[model samples]
Target: MNAMRLRALLLASLLALGAFAQAPARGGALPPPLPLFPLDNWWNADITHAPVDPNSAAFITYLGAGRGMHPDFGGDSGDPSAPIYGMPYVIVASSQPLVPVTFDYDDESDYAAPGRTPGYPIPNEAKSQQRWIEGGLAGGDADADGDRHMLIVDRDLRILYELYALHWTGSRWEAGSGAIFPLDSNARRPDGWTSADAAGLAILPGLIRYDEVYGPDPIRHAFRVTVRHTNGYVFPASHRAGNTSGALPMGARLRLKASVDLSRFPEPMRKIFQAMKTYGLLVADNGTDLYVTGTYDTRWDNDVLNPAFGAIKGSDFEVVQLGWQPSRSDNRRRSVRH
Candidate 1:
């Protein structure tokens, strides 16, 4: 073929290929949806878009008449200028990536708590089958904070594994709690039960990723935060009494009050705050008041992220309408996904 004609034909083919590569699904529809849980899980199922809990007003009133809200996330990690700067994030990378691991545990471990195993060179997975070889144990304590939550996602396998207080004693992986979760479900921890996290909730479900801020997708779920006090439990929350108290019970879901103003914040911060307003936060553990959870990424600039929510306060949040589901039977999920 003539050189000019050949060049023109090649250019036309390339243009067509580029458009096809970026095209939407058939009928111009969006891609298939991701599940609501696990590492790949975004906030698509977040309560913000869900119907308002009919009992939100009463729950807020019960928490207190004059209670103020706080932002657990913001400012910089270890920077004085940041409001919630003291908290750190744990970044996963150590050990074998995307592989399950076996560990030795104390009497408190879920495997031991159930009381099924006897002496063994390796503990059995009859009860804890999912724990052995889940995620890579090589995670860093980003904020230098002791929470040491480890999250590993096997993207190829479409699975997410989580652990709390995870540590490698140079021999075996030990942790305060551990859980195996399928990335494809809206499932909560079984009612009146617990997972690797104290709140019986999966840790990855609530954490904010840096990409979520930079990407088109909105964070679709609630943020997991801690508080020193809570009354009882709530629904979507499967467990109760992570050691119980006059304070809140395990699985309590609290949302950012809708009335709060988010207009002044920047785009990224506004997205997060808007999520708080709509989806609110879940009480996953006992800690300082209103500390929300997020992952570690070096790309974050403390200067920008910290000041984004500077004007927000904790009292601005209100308890949303969610009641505790006390029994496994009461909150039994027939399948992983509803």
Candidate 2:
């Protein structure tokens, strides 16, 4: 072949390879940042008692916040600093086992509670709520104590969302019916604030919506939810907003540090983590009360050691870095982006 022809052919091959490398395999615009929070500072807080005003945008922000899981780093077993603040507020109202709830994404009915067996007449309440009694529903028998429910509301006291478990008596599946509960009353703040003072601050989702980005592949992403309840401490709400001027409402103004061991995840999730090549952080405006976000990244081949089960050499997972800055404006609920 002529020298010029050979050069042109080589260049074309290089360009094609670059395009292939940049294309996303199957997932959509990098899965919206997983709901990952911080591990230190504030760990848990309850906003169930906080009044939610349906008329205000804050109310919508609050509802959006309950959409994902808030993870944490170091504290007591249930509470951590990276996620939300308020320990008593972090209620898990699942009738199903935590293991199965977190691991078994395949069995849509695995999280359902055992219902009345054959021969026993369904209770009147169960019959009246036939939709909930059916199988394949998100709702189920809540924990016996009833402490698992957490309510998300706007500043106007409007109930935005409810997080709880459910039980199934009949044999059908649905998404809405379940055992719902509210957070303990002690975690909320006294109401009475204008929309302007709370501008830029909003509620963020707790669960990182992975299916939107990762597709059907099962990958476990670790995150932290930190809630800082300033009941006694007072700061200018306007000042908070001033500090975060010109940033995304749910962006991170502060950076935090965290680490995860891919080996901790089971089978497919573990394998998916191994295949990752890059990752990024995503945060949502849960409510004007707290900041929630998570990390989504490609796994480096070297960080794939299964230390929990046995030592296997892989990559040393990078220590996640984070930061937090006090906003200048009194807008106590400033949404920050990194």
Q: Name the top lDDT candidate.
A: 1
Question: Candidate 1, which segments miss by more than 4 Å at Cα?
Answer: 1-145, 241-246, 324-338
lDDT of 1 by residue, 1-338 (tens): 99999999999999999765532211111122332453223233344433445655554454554544444443334553222322232222112222233443343234321222321112222122221222211332222335555554433333445665654444455566656554566555666665656666777657665667766766555677877665555655555544443455656666666787788877888888877875567777777665666644445665666555445555465554455222333223212332
- Give the residue spans of candidate 2 off by over 4 A: 1-143, 150-160, 163-204, 212-254, 257-338
Give the Cα lDDT of each candidate.
Answer: 0.50, 0.25
Candidate 1 to truth, TM? 0.61
TM for every model, in the order presented, reads 0.61, 0.22
Per model, state how many residue pairs clash: 32, 101
- What are the C-alpha RMSDs, in order, of all predicted structures? 11.0, 20.4
